[model samples]
Target: MKAAVWYGKHDVRIENKEEPVVQPGKIKIKVAWTGICGSDLHAYHGAPGVIQEGTPHPITGEMAPLTLGHEFSGIVHEIGEGVSEFAVGDRVTVEPMIKCGKCEPCKKGYSNLCDYFGFVGLQSNGGFADYVVVDDYMVHKLPDKVTLEEGALMEPAAVAFHAVKSSQMKVGSKVAVFGVGPIGLLTILCAKAAGASQIIAVDVSKERLQKAREIGATTVINGMEENAVQRILAETGGVDVAFEAAGAEVTVNNAIASIAKKGQVVIESIIPHPIKVDILQITAKEANLTATLGYCGVYKEVIAMVASGQLDVKSIITNKIVLDDLIENGFNLLTSDKSQAKIIVSPQ
Candidate 1:
């Protein structure tokens, strides 16, 4: 099997590696398409929180050197003994959250908060290779109407779905989303489907703002050019909910400031650096400040939703690269100024 292995900072080698060995109670997938996530790019260059240098995963116990990719869909080529929920040739995408099913969080339906939670790519060898193994519970069979490309995207889509759901969005509610990246774009789509009457998308990129409108953004604000807070307030009178998807402190603040009285602020982005946030906004507006980690049990629901035509996630795919072209394509991602969306990888 040919696999792209990360050896050092900014170094990835495509070479033949032994096929993964099958074991009981595990599921093996024949990789079809793997979406390149932001964390992968960060990890490739040895960025923090993506992976710890020379440190082993607490759950899988694999060290910093890892096969990188988590958002993927594939065919179940083989199933381990005692696995009967799926069989050969079942089209599916995985949850990728490796958790102890017996944990308190898992039993309480908060497996994303599991004490020993380990993400597929972050903690173990992921779908960057031809074959990857996971527990059977992590795999979800896709509906016949969904394509492999869309199936691979279920991972991120589920995250977006969970963000809105966790925010407790209501029909005809006003939503202001900060950032227009892939996750932000998808959140816009979900917000509309959830019946948000006014969807305000804010970003620094004009191009991304345009894409946001195409997807479902009722209005857009270029924070670099206009005051996002003023722009949002003018449009919706006052936003009923605010979604912070940019992960930057300024954007986080903007999302908080844009909310109306008694609204909710949903923090969907991963803020790694320490940053200041005003508690007065929450107190003054009586707003609920909530955050969601990774998603749990939303993969299949998103797949079916996309298949049923309620959501169209394909508008955000800006680049598609094969395993052989990862380095060249990855370089473009590193240097490009435009906010190009997702880059899907065909590992085969």
Candidate 2:
């Protein structure tokens, strides 16, 4: 089996390794397609705290130098003992989240907030390989209409779906997404499917903003060219809900300022460093500011939406490459190209 192993910063090597085998309560999947995620890019740049280091991850009991992909879809090649919901040759996409079921948040059905939360690619050997084994609980069967390529996007789509579902936005409410990156673009799609009346997409990239318009965004604002917050306020009297997905201080503040009174702001990106925020802006609006983690309890719904053509997730896929070219054609291309959105890799 060939796998992309994350040894350290700027150090990902495609090495041939033994294939993973199924164990009790596990499933061996023949990986079809895997998407290179923003988190993977973060790890590639030596961003700390994402890939478990030094001490092992509590769930997977593994660390860096592990395989590097989580947003993947595959065919179940084998099912371990005690697994009955799926059998051989089932088409599936994995949730990839590893949580401690005994934690308070997990006990309350908020496993995304579990005390010992982790992910498959970051914590253990993942789908950046020909075959990978995962806990059977993480598998979700793909619908007949969903292709393997679209299935590879379910993980990120779930994140967007969870963010919109967790927000205070109601049907017919106006919404703004600050950042039209892959996740941000997907957020727009999910917000539209959730019945948002007007969707505003903000980004510095003209190409991404254009793509946002083609998707479901009713208005696109280039933050570099115009004042995003002011424009959003002037046009729609402020959106009913705002999402911060740029992972930058300016966008975060803009998202906060672009919301109407009592409107909600959801931070969907992993802003690595702490930055100063205008407390008065939030105070004046009486708005709620919240953040979403990976995802929980939304994979099935996201899959159904894509399968029914309610959400055209495939529109965001800008490129596709084989596993051998993941680093140059996939990772590096995404890092250097602003127009590239989601890049899916075929490991086999």
Candidate 3:
């Protein structure tokens, strides 16, 4: 099998490795498409704590130099003992989260907040290969209408959907998303599907803002050219919910400032460093401020939405590459190209 292994910072190598064998309660998938995620980019830049190192992940018991891809979809090639729900040739996408079921959060059905929270690509050998084995619990069968390419996006779409579900958004509610990256674009789509009346997207990139408009954003604001917070406040009289997905201090503060009285703000970006925030802005609005981690129990709903044509996720996919070109055509291209979004990799 050929896999992209992350040995260290700026060091991902496509190497030949032995294929994994299925085990009890596991399923071996012939990987069809794997999407390179922002977390993978963080790891590529040597961001600490993204990938388990030294002592090993508490759940997967594996560390760096492991395969690096979490957003993926595939066909079941083999099913392990004790797994009866799926058989060979089932189309599926993985939730990819690793959690300790005994933890309080897990016990309360919030395993995304479990004490030992980790992810497949970050904590174990993942789908950046020809074949990968995962716990059967991670698999979600794709609807016949959802193509394998769209199935590859279910993981990130789940994240966006979970963020909307976590917000206080309602039918006809006004919403603003700060940062129109892949996740942010999906957030706009999810907010629209959730019945948001006016969807505003903010970003520094004109290209990304255009992409946002193409998807579902009712309005687009280029933060670099205008005062985003002031513009949003003037137009919507303060949105019902504001999402900070840029992972920047300025955007976070703007999101906090752009909400209505008692409005909610959700942070969807995985910011690597702490940034100072204007606490008074949130205090004055009497707003709710929360953040979302990896999703929990939303894969089925996301898949159904895409399958039913409620979400045109495929519209966001800008490029596709083979595993051999993942580093240059996928990772490097994503880093250097602001217009590129949702690049999928095929390892098969």
Candidate 4:
């Protein structure tokens, strides 16, 4: 099996490794298509969280030299003993999260909030290879209408769906999404599908903003060209909900300032640095601030959405590369190309 292994910062090598085998209660999947996620970029740049270096991950108990890919779809190649829910050749996508089922949060149906929550690619061997093994519980069978390429996007779509579902967004309400990256663009589609009347997408990237419009955004704001917060306020008296998906301090500030009084702001990005917020402004507006982590249980819903043609997730794909070209064609291209939205890697 060939796998892309992350040894350190800016160091990813495609090396040959033994194919993973099916274990009892687990399934071996022949990886079809995988997406290069933002978290993968973070690890490539040596940002800690997913790629455990010195200390072992509490859950997977793995460290660096990790295989880096989670947003993927595959075919059921082999079933482990005691696993009868799926048969070989079933097309499926996985819920990459690994949570401690014994935790109180897990018991309360908030497994994503579990104390030792981690992801497959981040914490253990993942799908950036010819084959990967996972517990049968994490697999979700894709509908016949959804192709493997589209199923590769189910992870990120579920992320966007969960972000909107966690926010206090009412039907016909106005909303603004700062940073029209892949997740931000998907958020736009999710908001529209959820009946939002006015969707404003803010981003410095003109290409992404255009995609946002094509997807569902009623308005697009180029933050580099205009004051996003002022423009949003002057036009609509502030949106009902604002989503910060850029993971930048400026966008977070703008998301907080772009909402109306008593509005809600949902934080969807991972900001590593400590930043200041306008506490007085928040206090005066009487608004709410909520933060969402990885998705809880949105895979089935997103699969249904794709099956019904409600979300054209495949349109967001900008590039596809073979496993051999993951570094040069996939990672490097995504980091340098602003127009590139989502890139899928085929480990054939």
Model 2 TM-score, 2 decimals: 0.99
Q: What lDDT does each candidate get?
A: 0.84, 0.93, 0.93, 0.91
Model 1 per-residue lDDT tens digits across residues 142-211 = 8888899987788888889999988868999999999888889999988998999999999989989999
In the range 102-176, model 2's lDDT, one tens digit per residue, is 989999999999999889999888999999999999999998899999999999999999999999989999999
Q: Which candidate do you rate higher for lDDT, 1 or 2?
A: 2
- Predicted structure 1, TM vs. truth: 0.96
* Poorest stretch of ten by lDDT in candidate 1: 330-339
lDDT of 3 by residue, 13-63 (tens): 999999999999999999999998989998898888888878888778788
RMSD of 2: 0.8
Q: Candidate 4: RMSD over Cα atoms?
A: 1.0
Compute each candidate's TM-score over C-alphas. 0.96, 0.99, 0.99, 0.98
Candidate 1 wrong stretches, greater than 4 Å? 334-337
Residue 160 of model 2 has an lDDT of 93
**Model 2 clash pairs?**
none
User: How far is each candidate from the true structure, as Cα RMSD in Å?
Assistant: 1.5, 0.8, 0.8, 1.0
The alpha-carbon deviation from the true structure for residue 323 of candidate 3, after best TM-score superposition, in angstroms, is 0.4
Error of 1 at 104 (Å): 2.6
Q: How far out, in Å, is residue 10 in model 1?
A: 1.4
